[model samples]
Target: MLSEPEVAKHCAALLEHFADYCEQMDEATRGYVVRLAWELIGDQMDRPSVRRTRRGH
Candidate 1:
């Protein structure tokens, strides 16, 4: 399992790449790119540790 900071860093990197792809992609291809990103992030977030937040006082 990744630590919180590592997960955040990876998410940022994924967003950066997604933004770059979105810029270069044509309108028709943009949806595919967005869907691909959504799937990737969704998969990561589905992990148990990442899905739950610590309880607050």
Candidate 2:
């Protein structure tokens, strides 16, 4: 398994990539991407942090 810091770094990159991919799509496609992202984010909002602990939560 990756160390906590390493996993966080990778997830950050992936989130960036997801945003970039959405931006590059046509308006119709972008809507789908945005909706999917929102769904995933909403599903996790109340869950404990999956990333490393820091000075702030």
Candidate 3:
């Protein structure tokens, strides 16, 4: 089994790819991509960390 840190790293990489996909996608597609990203991260990471806004604003 992968360690927590390894899973976090993989999630981060997937988030980056999702960001890239969002940039190139239409509005509807971007929204879907973002939702998929949120679901993936939520499943893999701690609830508190995953729930925080990305910008920390």
Candidate 4:
């Protein structure tokens, strides 16, 4: 299992890579991808660790 710091580091890297990928996509595709990403992220925010982190526990 990853610690919060490790997860944060990986998420940062992934966001940077995702941004680069979106830059190469057309507007419509980028919008779709961003929406999907947010949906997935919102879903993940329900996990225990994520909820704890969000609440600053």
Candidate 4 Cα deviation (angstroms), residue 19: 1.0
Kindly list the per-residue Cα lDDT of model 2 for residues 10-45, writing each as its tens digit: 756766887878767899987676555555445432
- Quick one: best lDDT, which candidate? 3
- Which of 2 and 4 is the better model by lDDT? 4
Give lDDT tens digits, candidate 3, residues 1-57.
Answer: 225888889878878877767677899988777666756655543456556446755
lDDT of 1 at 29: 89
* TM value for model 4: 0.44
> What's the true lDDT of residue 20 in model 4?
85
Residue 9 lDDT in candidate 3: 90
Question: Quick one: best TM-score, which candidate?
Answer: 3
lDDT of 4 by residue, 1-57 (tens): 234778768866776788988878999988776665665455443356653322555
Query: Between candidates 3 and 4, which one is better according to TM-score?
Result: 3
Cα lDDT for residue 17, candidate 4: 82
| Residue-pair clashes, model 1 | 0
Error of 3 at 14 (Å): 1.2
The deviation in Å at residue 48 for candidate 4 is 24
Better of 1 and 3 by TM-score: 3
In model 4, the runs with Cα more than 4 Å from the true position are 1-3, 36-57
lDDT (C-alpha) at residue 21 in model 4: 88
| Arranged by lDDT, best first | 3, 1, 4, 2
Model 2 TM-score (2 dp): 0.43
Clashing pairs in 3: none
Worst 10 residues of 3 by lDDT: 44-53
